[model samples]
Target: MADGRVERGNQTRRAVLARTVDIASVDGLEGLSLGKIATDLGLSKSGVFALFGSKEDLQIATVRAARAVFVERVVQPVQDEPAGLAKVWRLCESWLGYSGRRVFPGGCFFYSVSAEFDSRPGPVHDEIARIRGDWARYIERLLDEARLAGGFREAADPADVRQLAFEVMAMMELANAHSVLHGEAMDYERAARGILTRLRAATAAPEELPERPPAFDFTAGRPSA
Candidate 1:
């Protein structure tokens, strides 16, 4: 009987965090309120407060929950792939898909919330910065792996790899912004093309890179693969 009660409590907490992440993505973490979330979820405000204790605790939990979603959608999908240029490429594509698919109504949760808290000093800011740093290091590690596999040109430097990762990230964010503003999917195609072109240039064996269609056909209501 005690185990059942614990399981139910865990489920309620998960549900709360799921809704909290979506709300935080759209309105920024500063906008979150336990009463508002409780009302939205049709639960008692006191119950929600019991779960999180405070708004800051709720925000922290929301960030952690969103990070778990990110890992499941972007990182785990490509984890088993050959760890080299192909795996790196898969990571980029997965990220694009995650944003384009609207995993969060406001788009990339981290991207949206990071901008909100970047200049502020607090536990929330520190946590978001740590998440961003971890992602950057993951990209760098993938690039290093590709270099070790001889996929990149001998002239490629570690610094160059870092720059490329930054460029790819920029393209992803740009696409997210444009798509959200204009409601157009073509932005993703443009981003993908830019990433593919950059990767091809650095590739030691360009032929090993995935083939793209001759042109993107937006009239068909879907971009060419």
Candidate 2:
């Protein structure tokens, strides 16, 4: 009986965090309140507070929740693909898809929350920075893997590949903004083409490279969140 009660509590906490992440994605984390989240989820404010302790705790928890969603949606899918240039390309596609699909309703969760906490210094900011740093490192690791697989030119520098990863990040964020503000799906295609061009330039065997995948079509319907 005690185990059942503990399991129920854990489930409720997960439910709260899921909703909290969505709300934080749309409105900055600063906009979150225990009372508001409790009301939205039909739970008691005290119950919510009991789980998170304070607003900062809740904000940090929300960021953690978002990171889980990001990994499931963006990272794991590409990891399932074979490593090398293909994996790297798919990683770029999945990221664009994640943002284009509006998985968080307000666009990329990290991009939105990072902008909010970037200038602020605290646990929340630190957590966001850690997430960003970890992602950058992941990109670099994929580039290194591709290099070992003979995907890139023998002369390509790891530092240069890391820089290319940063360019891909910039294009993705720009695509997200353009899609959100102007509703231009073409921005996603442009970003994909730009990434493809960059990758092709680094290709060790241009003729042996796989054909590029079609750009995501946002006009049809949003991908499942």
Candidate 3:
């Protein structure tokens, strides 16, 4: 009986988090309420409240859950790829696909939530900021690794890994922003092409990346393999 009860509670928690992530992505974490989520999920308000404890706690958990989905969708695929210019390019490609395919319904979960909470001061804002910082650091680390692997040209300013990562990340965020606001993915192609140009200029192996942006069926909401 004890084991069964625990398993059921875990299932309920997962169910609540799944709904909360999608809802928070589109509406921001401040939009979440225990009562409304309980009503929508047909679960008791007290039960949902018991699992999360407070509105802020629920929002924090939702952000954490969205980060997990982001990792699985964008970061994990190229995890084992050689840590060189190719890996960096592939990682950016994954991010574009994740956004273009609407993995979060609002494009990038962090992008929407970060803009919502960027100026606000609270635990939710801190959580979002920390995760975003982690992403920036991750890109910077990849760029450093690529340089060590001799993936960059001598005259390409490979020493400025931070700037490269910054530019790449900025382009990606713009893609997500434009796609969500305009309901079109023109920015994805533009970002992809722009990034490829930057990467090629940095690396001696220009052939390692596509000459053009990867083909995508934007109407079908798919990015190329």
- Which whole-number lDDT from 0 to 100 does residue 115 have in model 3? 89
Residue-wise lDDT of candidate 2 within 1-225, one digit each (tens)?
Answer: 999988888998999988988888889899899998899999999998988899999999999999999999899986966657767877888888888878888888889999999999999999999999999899989988888777886677788888888988888899888887887778887888888777777877666444554757554433332
Residue-wise C-alpha lDDT for candidate 3, range 1-225, written one tens digit per residue: 999999999999999999999898899888899999999999999999999999999999999999999999889999899988889988998899888888788889999999899999999999999999999999999989888888887644544999999999999999889989998878899999999899988886888877777776665655656
Candidates, ranked, TM-score: 3, 2, 1
Residue-wise C-alpha lDDT for candidate 1, range 29-135, written one tens digit per residue = 98899988889989999999999998888888999999999999899988888767777777877887788778887888998999899999999899999999999
Q: Candidate 3 has what TM-score?
A: 0.95
Minimal lDDT window, size 10, model 2:
216-225
Clashes of 1: 0
lDDT winner among the candidates? 3
Which candidate has the highest TM-score of all?
3
Off by over 4 Å in 3: 155-159, 218-222
- TM-score for each of the candidates: 0.92, 0.93, 0.95
Q: Give every collision pair in model 3.
A: none
User: For model 1, which pairs clash?
Assistant: none
* Lowest summed lDDT window (length 10), candidate 1: 213-222
